[model samples]
Target: MESGVKKLKKGEREFAITAGVFFVGLIIFLLAGWTVLPRLSYAEKVQPVEFRHAFHGEDVGITCDTCHFFYKDGSWAGIPKMEICVDCHVYLLGQSPEEKKFVHEYVLKNRHVKWGLYFRQPECVSFSHSSHVRMAKVACETCHGPQGLSKKPTEYRTNRITKYSFVVYGAEAPSNNYGGLKKEKSVWGTIRMDECADCHRSRGKSTACFLCHK
Candidate 1:
């Protein structure tokens, strides 16, 4: 009987050790998933021309709507074309090396700078900047963060699987408290579909299936 008891205790000891190892392995797996996996899933691409938003907004006193504006027909003129840059950048305004590269490589050569977009939404999704900005009076920084105040261009990171930029998922944006909504941790660093639904629900807006999806 004593030998049987000793065997039972030995089995229990083995089980405890197995469980402890499994628990520690699970924690390591979770940590790697949260940190390492995301970095592996994306590829970074550099912007063609280095544009300083702080210099334009703070130093030159240009507003957000000045470059990104809506046309007379209510359609959004998303990114400014080369013609818009020509107004101020036709000739080298500053002695900065970047300005020289822009004037010589693009402005003088009449080539459009193939700027990388960090916020290119999926084709099925239709986002109206006019409705959000003009009607709702939503600030650009609310969704885009303080990009207008950035001293350097943001590095564009694209997911290999979705071919979509990851900035909307990882970039820091203004808190949900901007539009009288309760602040949420999930809504701060993400612009995913669920977060959009949360924002709409908080604002008493419709979360209908056809609202965002085409």
Candidate 2:
């Protein structure tokens, strides 16, 4: 009778250990599904843009501020107006005939260039441009990556299915990452939460949930 009781307890212990392992594995599988998989939007499909940033940034020596102008303050002067390009044609720097035709037809004719923004702050975010640009005196290249180096205009490719646009970096969606790199000058990258965290932490400011989410 004593031996049988001991044997029953040992079997129960083995069964309990097996159950614990199974439970732990199940929890890990669910966690991965929640964090890693959804990091990418399912709606997004890859779009191909022929323009290469490495060629422009390294070879052409174009500064990022040419397009992304920043004032003396910390606030950024958002997208450039058409007036900036009134004097310059896309063909200014070794542009091909195709570029000339496109520019003459669209930008020259007063049609707006429809470059999609990848890094968009939420409307509710209430970000001030003057503070970050004029007050903070942040560099244009600090947030917006350099673009002046490209010899020709980049081809615009949008994923109709995912509604995401791709540049040299990955999708230019607000939620999309600023490529995996740390600095703006790093090879094509996305903006990630870590970047925001670093900025806020370094400044000793609290980026409250209310400050970011709508």
Candidate 3:
């Protein structure tokens, strides 16, 4: 009977050790996932020009539609071309060094500012800004946040593997309680597939594969 008791105690001790090791391993895995992996997976990029939206919107009284507008045929003009900038930016209106760089480097040289696009979707995905903006009456701030009122440029982080902006995959949304990544209703709203589906469902829109996918 004593021999059997000793054997049982030995088994329990082995189980405890194994449990402890697993707990430690899980902690290490979680820590690396939260911190180290993000640095390795994403590469930060700076836009050619640090354009201030607040200055244009508040100070100069330029609206969002002024730069980003739809054509007569209802096709979305994604970004403002050099022709649009040349009209107002022929000469520096502000004392910003970036404005001087813009006038000298791009405006004078007849080169377009190659702005870093944050909402660059995959080729397979067909997103119609006209349908969303004009037909549905969805505000630009709904998906893009308060970018028009932003004083500073956003930190553009792109995933090296997917070659897409981190916003496409949905960054961690701010929350009061600790939880996994979810849709954000705050400043930087998530644009993931799930969030899109949620939006469609809320609005009673169809989520057919062909509707979004090519």
Inter-residue clash pairs, candidate 1: none
Candidate 2 similarity to native, TM-score: 0.49
Candidate 2 regions off by >4 Å? 1-66, 70-75, 90-93, 145-167, 170-194, 208-214
Determine the backbone clash count of candidate 2: 27
Residue 66 lDDT in candidate 2: 66
Model 2, range 3-46, lDDT digits (tens) per residue? 56455467899998999999999999988777655444332322
TM-scores for the candidates = 0.76, 0.49, 0.79
The residue-by-residue lDDT of candidate 3 on 65-122, one tens digit each, is 8888888988888888999888898998888898899999999998888898877778
Please give, for residues 9-122, the per-residue lDDT of candidate 1 as tens digits: 678999989999999999999888877786787776767887878789899899877788899878899889999989888898998998999999999999999888777778
After superposition on all C-alphas, the RMSD of every candidate to the true structure, in Å, is: 6.0, 8.1, 5.2
lDDT of 3: 0.73
lDDT of 2 at 201: 85
lDDT of 1 at 51: 85
Worst 10 residues of 2 by lDDT: 42-51
